[model samples]
Target: MSIQGSALPARPYRAFLFDMDGTLLNSIAAAERVWSTWAERHGLDVAAFLKTIHGARAIDTITRQALPGVDPEKEAQWITEAELDDVDGVVAIPGAVEFLNGLPGDQWALVTSAPKALALRRLQAAGIKPPAVLVTAEDVARGKPDPACYVLGALRLGVPVQDCLIFEDATVGIRAGEAAGADVMVVTSTHLTPMVTAHACIDGYEHIHVQRDSDGLLYLQRLAS
Candidate 1:
């Protein structure tokens, strides 16, 4: 699919919500290594497993894709521990650090499918600071495409869901953000295919600048198309 290079209309959004793995931090290699190894060990189909696992929670993927009778909790715990053990290749998405650092700390939050421990390690590996409000997989009963995590993030940030602008790299995450009533923007740093539904798609945060007005409304400006 061709890249969608349209402009996201300016809005007076009160908060920015971010997805960790692909949107803010590039962890494709590390994740692929972890999940594929788990899949191989369980004799599961690697192609199908990789396809659905990226955007959702490990437990959800295990229950849906892993073989029958597998203990979802145990499998999820193993994957989470494995991820934490090897965050060596994870790094900040281009422009992610600057863009995040520029925002008002309270006006932004990270809502990720990763468990809290794994999420914190990845952020540290990428040299990105965890936001004041972080909604992890453990924080919600359901994961992406469910909107539970995103909704919780908004509430924790003390902002209305409708007042949020979300940055996501997966279709499932986009669904969650939209369902949460926030305008979702896709980041192409991960998936390049035309598989996501979002207000706009950006290559990375490299060309985007963010600030807040006197009234605390976030001001977002894309320096390039």
Candidate 2:
């Protein structure tokens, strides 16, 4: 089942850092729902607002979406409330749970733009409890496209940034991992193109496999046959 001539060298990937929203879970629907509701309530275009805020932090999005006379902090609070309470459309991406369960908690962590309360709530709705280190928006001064989240995740995992492998879905997340010096793997859950151009496309767990024991130790299986 090994890839006989793949360009990526076969090596033991020491650590794993994961992006939450579009990467591990299909939360776009939920995100859109909340954002749309807020936008419509605020007399903003839902479509345009979503496009502007995709892959951005809530505070940044709030500032961008702020009405001429509205307070940024007030708008941000509203966004947090709307997003945290809206989970109707949240669901795990294909193979997400399996991939997570197959990974050792000690070797991996979740790095997300969402704050801890929101991230944990979404993970719960998606039915996946986050493991050891969960780096949220509050943990960093800068969001994705800035490597702080990935770097923090690696540090919390007790692994060097160079030894970490990141799984992300957005260009920003991928860039963050790359900036952090981790080997970045992109999943196509939310991507629209064919040539994903990140690290790899895990079509299914059957293709890119993993295994975890009772003690939480993990190992990757051979590539799909």
Cα-based lDDT for every prediction: 0.87, 0.75
Candidate with best lDDT: 1
Candidate 1 TM-score, true structure as reference: 0.95
The count of residue-pair clashes in candidate 2 stands at 0
Residue-wise C-alpha lDDT for candidate 1, range 1-225, written one tens digit per residue: 225656764887899999998999999999999999998998978888788788899999888864777899999999999999998789999999989989889999999999999999999999999988999998988889999898999999988988999888887898898888888888877774666353688778888897678899987787855
Off by over 4 Å in 2: 1-9, 41-43, 65-67, 193-198, 204-206, 211-225
Q: Cα deviation in Å at residue 56, candidate 1?
A: 0.7
Looking at candidate 2, the ten consecutive residues that score lowest on lDDT are: 1-10
TM-score of each: 0.95, 0.84
